[model samples]
Target: MPTIPSNIVVYNLITKRLFSTSTSKNMNYVEKVRLLDYWKIQDSSLQNEFPRSHLVLMVDRRLLVTKDTPDVKMVEHSYGDLKQLLGEYGLQFDLSNSCLLDALPADNDMIPLFGTSIEAADPPEDSPISKSDVLKQLGNSLGGRFTDIRMAMLTMQEERQRNLLAKFQTLTKWAATYRRCPKCAAALKMRTSKSGAECVTCQKVYYPTFSPVSITLITDPTNEHALLVRHRGSAGGVFTAVAGFAHSGESMAECARREIAEEVGIEVDLIQSLDMSQPWPMPDSSLMIAHVAIAKMDQKISVCPDELETAQWFSRQQVRQALETTLSDPQLKKLPRTLDDRQTLHYIPPAGAIAHQMIRRWVDGKIDFHNSRI
Candidate 1:
């Protein structure tokens, strides 16, 4: 039997969207024909079609945006607009180096463009051109700023747009990483269908891969407190549920238990799985499978010093307070100076994260940790 049931709805920062999933695929036959025409023309030459209003440009991993005003403005340049901007930076504008991130179903003219510079020279290995330096130059040329992709995902309001951005990032990264065949040392070319790469020499087709990870929140036997750990080099004062990549040939339940034991030296009985899964883009694309577990015999945690900085059990009340702390604005809210004997500088994962969702569910009486314990 599968540890994670099929009916469970996986939760994660990027997976939960406010908009319906069908929004991206709602085009009619006329629209489909129009899009086919656009692609046909685009395949021939970028000069054939008129430029749209917005273009989402990604150089390496950063996004070009305008941050001069209070609200950050993403740079959505039309083909002509982007062409002019690239010309100023001594970059070429080629359709071969660009792709559509997403198209608007409502407005036929509102197509989102994603472009990367294919002609830029590879920097030397010893002293490569810094990502910051490249972004600075691009920002200067475009008269805008560049923001990290993670930051952009956090601040972007439109759910559909965020989903599109993730797809773009995932596809672009896959292309860069799989430029050569793994089976044989041969160059690979994108398939005509644009779904995967095919090796020129061996003719092996390779598709994109997504890593699966298991993330769990373990509660004490009494179910009054939850175990949270701080990873080494994590942002100051922030702590989240324990997580690790699923090992080869291991079931999700087996991986969850092993990761819990390996990371914090705590034995846990597998409890009911959380219905939420999230797509984590950092450190590469991964599917985060979340679960709830209860500490078996040993409630006391022994932190793996190399992997985690600290491991502690926070009372349900404390977890609630930490969630509140994360949601409150810095200037408007004031937290207690101290809770019990510890300083009140606790910072939990952001509300968008699956970890935060698990904590919130536990606090809200939605997850019956004690009753669900194995």
Candidate 2:
């Protein structure tokens, strides 16, 4: 039994989008230095100061799983170079095994991860390059540079998240513990990133935030209402926004139209994207893309008991009140959250999931709350 919705953990604090992990920005000190041509060749002197963090080794980067670790160092890399490794040791990146972690603290910017093999460097007992030195090196490597760094300070003037106490529980048998590479079936090596997961195996990558799929917010113009469907396994006949996966060669808006037709027998016209996002962790993983759509020129309503148990239209007020929040439609009814059941764990979306997030955006002005174009 997990307190977290499946693999998802409710954020302990409310801050920026990088709400879970501190974004890599406003470094009181962030610099870049040339990888001292020779230092790039050694390591005997490297293990202690920057000893490979076991946790970091297992997973490239981490999102403050325990809130606080007195001694934690942060690194930022907008652009990096493998040239030093190439020039110094004649070692090339196993391009097939490298990855980039770019977790967003906000909508546009993200933190990045840059890595190379520990086996490549020459051992040396000297101070590591300064952030500016490294920045300089990075600038030089990319045929340019920037030593000054800027970032969002909403974390400082407002409130720094209270670091929670640390606890460790081994989910050795948890299938979610491992991920699959899109290119190959091999197990993925989870690394830290400003974005999301890093796969060291196939080199194919994934971000904590990925693609978004959407649901149709269909309505009955005559009745001034919308429709919702109850899936068979939902909570106590708990009803929710109608949704499903988008097919290939489909747009978020288009997916919304299709899912509505298949699940509840409705073909919509005037469709528009509301918002796009990823599902929470507890129940499952999905990039929720939300859309609002209406019948082309007339009323439309039909049902397919095969895909859903019941599909009916609800007034705007019904949806607003049921959500508990302006934009949410909680899964008051849900299936067992088990580690072993594929449909239960893998197929299901995270509870209080991103699906709600997209809707929330719709409720707000971020998405066209009154329009039908995404």
Candidate 3:
């Protein structure tokens, strides 16, 4: 049987290989590695001498990728490479519009390639441009189709690159949205030492924000079946585990129980933390804390029309089969028609998603309810 790649392994490999080249005579390899782990270049002027080759250019929210098989091959370009590409496209690199995502180890010997967002000015507000329209414009500017960041994250093989891209996207969005202080309406300036903005008027600093969400796979008391739900607004015929954002003061477990009850009108007990989390960027930036809980009281489900379109309990055998079908083809697949016309063949969430991971764990008998507390 094949096994999924662990996120920890991918993360470590990315950090190690992101800048593995030998340093200059003045710098040792150990120092370079340490710098890579600890450094963040904040000075804009110092970026001039930074190597262009190591830079990851994010134009708008899309990264430059090759138009080839797998379709997730990202282009690793240096500053010179970027200049040439921009010249060919009749565009210029505007530093004022760019920001440092990460800096290199040595003082001015910055490897600016770590994280950078370089793009032309954004369209004015009230222009009402759709995402597809923006992507089309970017594709023209880059000489290749601009893939959505979410799609790239899903298909990309390099976990490190994917994570970096997500961070870049999040940072870019944060910078744009928090240009002014929320309290006093004062213009916020970027702090030179870290990824934060400070207000000149109120002395308030604004950093990137991430919301917490709870996603759970609920099983019957006997653990013989799992609950699956179809969201009213979900794309495709896909069903997923019950999920909801954690309220301002709610615990993750409390959020999980509340979400289950509110979405499907059922109570869940024995909520055991899966201790697995994933950064989800869609709709908003959030950390999804995955969990497994047992359905308490009756098995009957009363779906909340506003929250879910359908809710049903699938037996362990059915869930295992579903996972097998999903694993065989990572893309959405359609099964043969059944007598029940209302029940269509639906796909599960992609593998990288915490929801899918939780389901896979449950299907593999890796999740234990015996140790769970009420």
Candidate 4:
């Protein structure tokens, strides 16, 4: 399995956990929502403009793909690659009952073929345009990537198959509710023909949700080592750099120091900024603000047990080897092993976590791995 992108972010504002289809096979109910990526689901205009190739969902939160047997059309490569993609991330998915091939209606010529990644996105709002330009914009938003789309098709574990109906119904209700005006008493409606919502009375528009956050790796004087901390209750198991949320009416740098103080109990200094960001989704809206900061005191360290267990400083050399795939998962023998604090890198974030992306940047110098601040 390709290293399941230890900190890859699929969408900045939303998140999905990575679990093997084998381990979670028994779950049903709300857990099944994992099957849907609400970030990319389309509206009515989307339906007329780009015929949906298929609707994939989990029957029992076990990895099932469902499609109307009669709705099959264009010859599609069986969705086997999706399985490989999941596996590389150290995750599992079931494909035994998945729809091997499916198609779309002929009139739906505007519909696009599926592939490995998100293809269409709303174009930047700053461009000047013409008719062809407008059409191209719409195409790019829906056409997505033309090939290598990794999808599991319609497959699921079975016990939760009946529950999917309720889940679909819930989504339909939310779709209708989302179209309404939250501020005004006026009834809201979906433009489905375009990119947002319309208020029937006030002519207001509401777009999809996107949230922003800030994350950083803080280091201290002498550049001998950087601030490393363990999460609360990690039992000195997992280790990671300091990071925190960027708050309202505050700058990213301010958030960096505040989070470091709150987590590691040290004052930050001589902070230099890095222009790398990742859209992290943990089931809510968030954009990762990745940066590097300096601390005044390198050796005087104390950790907050409620937020962090113990704090240490690791040299760049030790970090490079510790993060190596072959030797990455190290054992923690004492509460203070290296710095008289027993801590190991135990708590790795989600499959597409932002912290993971920042580490890669420090190592690979490939800011393009993420879409923002590259």
Candidate 5:
């Protein structure tokens, strides 16, 4: 999902590589992982070439993770090791519950990686080992704890590891939800490649996909201030850029323009795509496309009660201060009493989020809006 296919022949809006003119120098992009190359290997070839692959274990959307001082790591297990470990607890580890995630190169060999969900074991009534107890025992045995996917994504310091986690969560969710084909309601089997599922009855194929969303940070023509909005049910004082899903037959740039107009009742000009994006898997799978736009001279905002609670233009200095402030639990509580309040402090999305990166780049003058035009 990071890179578009070389032979991609699709909608005009998605055919291009989606290259952004402005790449931030301060951002550390994910490295050493090519999504297209990983999926290129056929399923049969992957199994024959690499019988023992690495497994990322998940239980109820929580990942098995361990902390190493300043860094966090996901626990990867070999096929035999995971099978034996799960067997000890009367659980199954096989293709029925696992999905192909990626193939990463290690030394001269390409190690296949899989995302697996551990289902609860059904014990007899007389058995003393409860499912919770078994899970606890498993965690203790692995010397790691099961952390929520969102928390793990936020805590992971390595970009490659974070991306892998996102991929695992997204793919597993896709597989779990689409077990039957829509055409005939027949059972679907996993495809050998990263392509997705195939229906046995009707010979239908379904590929794992993420919803495309455009997140735009609107700023004044002078670039002195940027606009942020608080959604209806978002956490206290958490304001983010205007964002909405890409409508069918519309390009991402068009989505940005329409979302800005609909969310804040203001038209924008000079829209520029940022050279960064993120695959968000929480709640659902989504590719967050980032953009920066300059609002027209008429800065008056009419808040959309349905989508946003309030929208306001914050000065660059104020936004920078908010970015620098540590948004701990205590800090968030004391920032602003209400969602619409214009207090001395404000809070934006945290690290790991595309919105945060976009806002940061703009504040640091990394997004060169001078050359960016419609």
Candidate 6:
């Protein structure tokens, strides 16, 4: 058994303790949702509970979700049903790779959710099932279709389900991508209840990887305006807070400062951290850390042409408008080009995104940089 990193261990302990308590006033949706708690169950008991537990299947990275309005629900299957379906599809349900993702709330029966993935079945030449036929047949049988995970995340009404899908996708992607150990090209087996994997030859355990990204909303000295930038290939008239991945051993705050300088050629001091961290799974798994940076003085708007199309400050009202637009229509992709005009309307990220939360907090005065850091 490979030793888990001490920092990760400490983080898990602290978060588990905090979430297990009743003090949920300030906790975010992700924090409020109950993650995997399989350590509480014995292996023998886990098997007994599996048949009754709800199964969330991810076929080729898409989530199985029922078509509905306002709230999208993940299609749940029994373990026996799952086994039978996989057998029909020429696939196997590996118990070792079945990951417990989340537990429903007390009012919802507190049923445990087991997430497992099955590759698209490549049927035999003589078989009637085609390459893409599995998805259609499974959808017909389950009364749901395989939905794009991103679309499912956006339309999901319940925050708990959204968080569960994010976790499930991240874990599933990690397992699928890293089949062999880095040190030795040996087959890896699921370990720690599929939360991690261990190399068969080296006995080294690999944990899920989440790259840390610093997303900061920069405010001027007056705190009346916020700085947002648009990448070259980004949607028209859409701008978002500065974001960059932290380099090795670099603090998140420093990463924010460096990104600000590199993208917009401005210097900013960290105001404070916000309670807006999110686990994003697109492009790659990332832990988005939110913060506020204040430009102590007037700064030039020298845009890094290689990095950004434009960088400019917008009034609180503008930011508010963009947020409202996002709320009214999250699917709105095209906006009138106005990155040059600081007074005009511009859009921010969707409400589910941490960047959107950061901007909203700044506008709502929740992120008061005027107050001294306690």
Say which candidate scores most in TM-score. 5
lDDT of 5: 0.72
> What is the C-alpha lDDT profile of model 2 across 1-374, one tens digit per residue?
13124322222112222322433343112111111111111122122212221121111112212113322222222222344423543434431232221122323222323332222234244747554454344334433333111111101111111110000101111223447766677766553221234456656655443234576566554425656666765543345577777788987777777777777776775776654443322223345566666653244556676766666665555554545532232222333355233122111121334444443443343444454432
Evaluated at residue 188, the lDDT of candidate 1 is 87
For residues 88-200, write the lDDT of model 3, one tens digit per residue: 64566644445455444444343644445665455567769865676566555554566677767666666556666666677667776887899999888764323678788
Worst 10 residues of 6 by lDDT: 34-43
Model 6 scores a TM of 0.76
lDDT (10s digit) by residue, model 6, range 1-374: 12556765566667667755634354456664433443322244356556667788888778888865556878888778878877875777765556777654443234457888877756778987676676778776767888888777656667677787888888877877778999999998755345677788988878889899988888887888888888777667668898878889778888888878888998886556776787778768888889888895476778788978787788888888888887787755556656454324456766666777788787888788667565
- The clash count of every prediction, one per candidate, is 10, 45, 5, 40, 1, 0
Work out how many backbone clashes candidate 3 has. 5
The alpha-carbon deviation from the true structure for residue 232 of candidate 4, after best TM-score superposition, in angstroms, is 3.2
What alpha-carbon RMSD in Å does predicted model 1 have with respect to the real structure?
9.6
Angstrom error at residue 310, model 6: 2.8
Q: Is candidate 4 or candidate 5 better by TM-score?
A: 5
Candidate 5 segments whose C-alpha is farther than 4 A from its true place: 1-41, 48-51, 106-108, 121-137, 192-194, 327-345
Number of clashes found in candidate 4: 40
Q: For every model shown, what is its TM-score relative to the native structure?
A: 0.71, 0.42, 0.76, 0.48, 0.79, 0.76
| Candidate 1 least-lDDT 10 residues | 11-20
State residue 339's C-alpha deviation in candidate 6, in Å.
12
Candidate 1, residues 1-374, lDDT tens digits: the string is 13224433232111223122334455555554445334422333223433552466766557776766544446677677778878775667554455445444434233434545344444457756764676588787776887777766545545555565666667667766888889898998763222367788997878767788888988877778888888876655667899999989998888889999899998886555787887766767777889888885455678888988888888889888777877774211342333332323376766546677787888887877545445
Give the Cα lDDT of each candidate: 0.65, 0.38, 0.68, 0.44, 0.72, 0.73
